[model samples]
Target: MTNIYNEINALEGAFRKTAEFETLKEAVEVVKADEEALNVFKNFRKIQIELQKKQLAGEDLLEDELVYAQKAAQLAQQNEKISAMLEAEMKVSKVIEEVNRILLKPIQTLYEDIQ
Candidate 1:
């Protein structure tokens, strides 16, 4: 069996150079420049992760945590820097998702043939 590690590395470098990734990087810098916005965003992410983990574990979410998440979402919506960063992040995620779909097409077809 052959490994495509080098090709994967090359694709990683290429992905970084893509326009989507570049825009995401710029958005990240904008967020980094605003300390308060960055901190708020970080807190929101932490809360989001914690909530998701709880949900996946079938644990009930605390009322305080729910309120905090709501407040965080509102604050992020009002913050231009954070909104831009989130939009850029979504764009990058979409690009990566499309790339993965494309890369998996051949494997998907092989599976279909076996079925």
Candidate 2:
């Protein structure tokens, strides 16, 4: 039988070498080089994480928090380096989503067969 862990590790290595991953790495480095951009990105990420946590905990999002998040997002978009990094991140996310779908095919097929 094939070792699933080994296969997963191999997949991870291959994923790291993909163009999307490389672009994201470069974009991150560019953001890191720009202090202002990095600060904006970090602030946005912090707000995002806080909002996500609140959502996961079943707590309501306050108006101020939503407004802050919106403003942070707008600020992040205004920073060229941060914007590039976000775009690169989206590309990497798409690749990961496709990989996840591919990996779930066996389970999906099994469920369909049961139905």
Candidate 3:
């Protein structure tokens, strides 16, 4: 078995001679890639928030449309009631005219007798 102290020293010497390991510039570039990936995640999160806002806006629009439809239907019903009332008023006016004609016979006879 290899002596532990000798192996440790030999590994240290080999690391000192190796320049192919991570240099300062290569390590900085790796850190920049990590930072850029983090920014991409942040931007994606912002897009998700914007999408949620748009969905809420769409829901509000649909609600407003429903409200308007309900108002329009109510107005239509009110107009129908008004129309029915007008028709009843015209019928009453016709009845009144007929009653006047029927009652005019005795009134004219009295007026002629007085004259």
Choose the strongest candidate by TM-score. 2
Give lDDT tens digits, candidate 3, residues 1-115: 8796897688656644444322323433443456544344344445546556767788443566556555544443354333343344455556557656766878888789674
Query: What is candidate 1's lDDT per residue for 1-115, written digit by digit as tens?
Result: 6568988899999999999999999989999999999998998899899999999999999899899899999998789999998999899999889989999999898899674
Candidate 3 backbone collisions, by pair: none
lDDT of 2 by residue, 1-115 (tens): 9999999999999999999999999999999998999899999999999999999999999999999999999999999899999999999999999999999999898899674
Clashing pairs in 1: none
Among all windows of ten consecutive residues in candidate 3, which has the lowest summed lDDT?
19-28
Off by over 4 Å in 1: none
What local distance difference test score does each model get?
A: 0.92, 0.96, 0.51
- The C-alpha local distance difference test score for the whole of candidate 1 amounts to 0.92
- As a whole number from 0 to 100, the lDDT of residue 69 in candidate 2 is 100
Between prediction 1 and prediction 2, which has the larger lDDT? 2
